[model samples]
Target: MTQTLEQIASCISGYDPNALPVAQAQEFIARLVPKVQAVERVAIRSALGRVLARDLISGIDVPSHDNSAMDGFALRGMDLADDGPTLLAVAGTGLAGQQFTGPVPPGHCVRIMTGAVMPDGLDTVIPQEFTTLNAEGLVSVPAGIVRTGDNRRLRGEDLARGDAALHAGRLLRPADLGLLASLGQAEVAVFRRLRVAFFSTGDELRSIGEPLGEGEVYDSNRYTIWAMLTRLGVDVLDLGVVRDDPQALREAFTRAAACADAVITSGGVSVGEADHTKRIMAELGEVLFWKIAMRPGRPMAIGKICEPGNAGREAILFGLPGNPVAVMVTFYAFVRDALLAMSGATAEALPPLQAVCTTGLRKKAGRTEYQRGIVSRGPDGRWQVEITGSQGSGILRSMSQANGLVVLHHGQGHVAAGDLVEVLPFDGLT
Candidate 1:
């Protein structure tokens, strides 16, 4: 997967790596992420939530011995009556983790418990519920009720020896911990956490607790990005807000480049008459300003920056939209996966779920639209979605109020009520 930017850029059909499409941008970011090569072995108990560095191979077969899958009588299938009912004397008991080693007579059966190893020379089992006990202390086997191997658990039934138990790049979950414990793994190899830095910029933007001057709004994008990055388990550095001045921005970018792996700014990439951030960004490194065919986050700039004190090292630069909602949309749509890649994670596609639209949606065919929506089960017990009150880029509440984002593709037309559309849920869908 080692690909130069040109090699990746060539895969796009129309091939404007500049005005990159959404899917192409996704691929480019995935290919460009320098997955952490450094690996450290941590105890399995401490490995939960960390990405595995290599495939986990099972050293031994699961259920290392042949065992019973149910509480039943263990007997040889050959000893069963082919057409008529049969009866056998209960000679012994086989409890779980215990064994029955006595030599049984021809007409004797072993009472076995679930998880107990099958008695020697036995191949079939009939549950105690299926057998009738008589005055003679014999168990009745109903005609045609039991089959050979019906309650037998073969050795290696759960997992075969030398099989790959878990693939690399997986974010270890609770079940993964159990699997590691089963495999007798005391420690696991994992990738190092990524280092990410973000900042907010706008002359009209004011940090919270500042004076409420005319034409000033609080800077909340930094907080949102901080929460999002923290959830990714990356080390985040908050660079605060940089004013519109070039010198102030230059110093911030320089310091950020030297200290962080990537720098994200929530503003100064649009086609407005007052955007000086792109110029300063280009002055420091190679950048591509794009008008992606997408809604709420059409204007974006991405590239690499090298500062003087960094000794020729470079850090990724993401110049996101200033609008509150647009910043979130672009981050979820783009930055999230890129950061995951940089952190040595595999590219995981967030597939959208099909849900009936409760309200109508009008969209053009040339651009992708991520309209906030509330997804829930309707009275019909079917999942449906409705757009939030306002999808304005500046209205952050639209995202806060909604539980999912309705993904309208570039080739899709206006959607009518009751029409099925694809939705990316905010919870669990990740």
Candidate 2:
């Protein structure tokens, strides 16, 4: 259902614009983002990493016939009565893709290979290893060895016919391809990939390969945002760095809103008299500047931007903080999931793994904090997390040295050494 901004905000109890809780901010974004309705039919191999537009129902039963699970003899359960070394005649052989025509006579068994259909009136199988065969073409089973219905695969055991095997809103994985193939699906429908436009906003930020002045720093946030967005399988449009001028920022926002489904801008969202980035964003659309109760990414903005001259040409906007580390932190914490939802992908949280902290840490309550961590196995073969030096928002090197983010909850307090904390590894993000 489509909800207005006010309608979505009313759902949250005691909603505060200035001091938004981390969870509340996430919830607000979830309720506001709209899913893409465009879909395309592609081969199973091309469907990997694409969001499934609809459930893929199984038209036929998997393993449509009852077959043997192993190379064994197929015999009636009554043939093993009393388990006293029963003797049976080896009737014939049943190989895969070949079924025996005539039914087995009483006390007669059929030699069945793996995946071969069971012969008529045969309900049990004794593995060849367990049975001894003589040169006279007779097989003998030990007493109380084989049970009834052992090593037989029933029809449609893996998947039933006319059942929904795969659900909608699922991001297809490698295993999903093999599963759809088992269902005899040649092509599957999936959502279209999202197009995202991103840019950095700051007069002091210089682009790479350009001459850097003594007071200017190279623009690294755009590059980092580009990499993160690309990993999510979206077509990214890098708009480079928009200067501090209001007119220049406005023109860039207009172009981005008209062409892309989502617009991501780093820097100029925070309070700064030298930049009019937030003011221009507010003029473009319904922009909500949020001081989210989260460390390293507190001052941010979220809203939708519409093209100046074109009606209904709008895009979701994320105005992230200027700091390199903060840009990444905010993107991973908020924007990543929102983009996934917008692209019709399922909303799945990255689960945090518990790891022992190697050093003491200071953190205040009432706000969540994400500290870059080096997660690795200690000498004791147990997972532990070590905080990178200088947890400053501008220290991008710390993020480079870390493989995980040590998450301190909104209500969490100071952590001591050897304390178990939640760490989200980068490899776990999908």
Q: Would you estimate the TM-scores of all the predictions? A: 0.92, 0.94
Clashing pairs in 2: none
Q: After superposition, which runs of candidate 2 have C-alpha atoms over 4 Å from their true positions?
A: none
Give, for candidate 2, the lowest lDDT window spanning 10 residues. Answer: 267-276
Residue-level lDDT of model 2, residues 1-430, one tens digit each, is 4566788889988789788889999999998888888999999988888899998888888788888998989888888968378789988899999998676899899999999988878988889899997778689888888788888888898888988898999989899999998887899999999999999988898888999888999999988898898888888999999999988998899989988999999988777635588888889998788899999999988888998887577799999998999998999899999999999988888998999999999999999999999999988888999998899999999999999999999999999999999999988765
Give candidate 1 misplaced runs (Cα > 4 Å): 1-8, 17-19
TM-score of 2: 0.94
372 Cα displacement, candidate 1 (Å): 1.0
Report the C-alpha lDDT of model 1 over 1-430, residue by residue, as the tens digit.
4444566667666857446667766666665556667788999998876889999999999988788888989988877898887899987999998988888778789999998888888888888899998888898898898887788899898899999999899988899999999989999999877778889988888888999789998899999999888878788999899999989989898888887888899998988736678888888887777788888898888888878756466788888999999999999999988887777777677888899999898998877899999999999998999898778899998888999999998789999999999999888433
